[model samples]
Target: MATFATSDQLLVIIDPAARQTDGESVRIAKDVLSAGAAAKLCLPEGPEEFARALDRRGSRRPVVIGDGRALVRAVTLLHRQRELAGCALSVVPVGDTALAESLGVPGGAVAAARAVLDGAERRLDLLVDDSDGVVLGALGIPPAPGRAVAARPVPIASGRPWYRSLVRTLASRPARLPAVPSPCAARLRVEVDGRTVVDLDQPVVTVSVTPGTDGVASVEVRPLSVGAEATPLLASGRSVTVTGADFRYRADAAVSGPVRRRTWRVAEGAWGLVLPAGR
Candidate 1:
């Protein structure tokens, strides 16, 4: 009888739908764990249960077996833990190429699993949204109607007032991406270091902020400008407030808010995560 070691304990949370759609991946992952003395896998029933499992897990490196959402759930849990000072996060991206492509994760689950067994832990910066939401890498503010809409034309976010993105309707087929209004203009009054930089008299579209060091908020405003010069403003401060008539906005991949105001404060180097060798 082969026994698993306590140090080899691993938690695997697979998305319910993904497991249903592709049973092979889960089966293969289980076999991979069974064949090795280095890993002992534990599966969570669902998302809520997954969180509970992670919470119960003191300091073990969590290995999530879903797509990007799984990664987000893990990060969010670690953020709430306050114990991520030196915890490693490993993911076996089993679905969708979007998130994995962005992270340079291999397309195969076995390869990702192999990397998990042999990879070194690296620290990566996590972004905090206005609502205290934790996001890895970049954040996208999807267009709101009368503000910015969800489009697929791929707007440029390069220059100062980087065109954050375009908004299009989900109903429209063939992905009709139109340059719409700013998503946050209707409800956002951007202030940099206590100085009001953008005060929208009319309804604007979207506002995206990349929070940086020393109270510096890298603010980018995307309005109805196919030609609007958006000057990226960096403000040094600890707080950022977004106010409106109670509207919903996308933070990272999660939808939050209908509140009058939502503010975000940065916690520098809050968590340590595992990343690729080059990153």
Candidate 2:
């Protein structure tokens, strides 16, 4: 267990979705946090209010009470404000906890709350895109011809201040994607740190990128095959770029796409999270 300073103040911002889905869990988390330290609670009904609540937080560590999407929203908000590096964030997972679990956060509300009170600050890497979008977990580009190249009319991240549109998009259920014909290999140009891993002539089965140690991203590109085993190209670098005919990619839970090209770079230790000691 890690020791916390008595003067450490906490700002508990409970998501409306969390309250609606799991009021009991939210209440338990609140009670645990309140008993553990100096805490101020804010219940934001929407994205705008969430932004405002964060802006009003004064010297208090921000603790989000929701699922993975909520945690992403909070991190994106802080990243947009250029405060992520300086802020230590905490989360009490209430709904879907997959993302939180991947980040080593406790699943139970009480344990998560206790972590917020006593956990140590851990700096983690982030994947930043050219469009100013952030990915906390992994990004995947699957081999689905038309589906990969076709762009969705609506963008998850829109031109809203403090990424309110992105927050709203994530808060709501994603629309069902239209059924595509079938899966086929896509010819994409993949590069890692300016080193060409595959050319457009090579059909790629899938591409995956995730944060790696030492401020680099681990990239893998699997080539298409005909009932035979094909080798996957693996590389680690600070940046990875993919170019092809319009394509869509999955970042965490949200999908963005139909772009000719996209690049992601590792923002080394750009954000801090509260986790158990020795995590």
Candidate 3:
């Protein structure tokens, strides 16, 4: 159960990197969105500045102005801003719009801003890790002979022809490991609601969970050695816990946790966000 409030208050946070690279586009988004609602632009200088901007967000609807990373930052901040539950979140998706697209946000700045004006909030699932950090979307882990794609900030708009022309591109090749002595494979002990599901000394490329009525269920798991194929992990239960040493994982597009262990709990319909019509 979540509450909803109708208002035009909003706070816009732009990633400084994105601002520096494409100031004009970001400016257009800001101006367009601001025209419709009371909005302020807060460009984060770095992670600290990012966190501080969120801390100062108050109770306004938050509009993120970067790529997937920007949206993840907004989600994490909103999760922390538990008081602002049910607030609208508008994203002027700038960088890799794939993740945001999957979430139903239009890629174009004007269209995204239009969504803010016309869209209604829908409930979306969020992951809460053991260390109390939050991830909005997918998480990736690298496998042996294949490094975790999360290790390097995969350039946001790598493959998109339009975006590639617009922003710097990341590696063209999929994540692969070093030719030298293969790095130690990641070993994770995963459990759902206290029951062991996977425990192995093998290489895992990625793990994801989506929220459901009963709990959080495993959405997908990919192994680096398996090429591009991904196996779907059954979704069931309210809690998931992962323990490992030197584990590198990506929650959504934001990277965190080289920590030994992490736990995630279903926040129970924590976030209500905009989705495409059918979703």
Best by lDDT: 2
Candidate RMSDs in order: 12.1, 12.8, 10.7
Q: What C-alpha lDDT values do all the predictions have?
A: 0.59, 0.87, 0.68
Ranking by lDDT: 2, 3, 1
Candidate 2 off by > 4 Å: 1-3, 143-184
Q: Rank the candidates by TM-score, best first.
A: 2, 3, 1
Residue-level lDDT of model 3, residues 129-243, one tens digit each, is 7666765655555422344354655456657688886564334556576556523345677778898656766555556665553446554544435445546455467787777
23-44 per-residue lDDT for model 2 (tens digits): 9999999999988889999999
Please report, as a residue range, the 10-residue window in candidate 2 with the lowest summed lDDT.
143-152
- The better candidate by TM-score, 1 or 2, is 2
- Best candidate, TM-score: 2
- Scored by lDDT, model 2 comes in at 0.87
46: Cα error in model 3, Å: 3.9
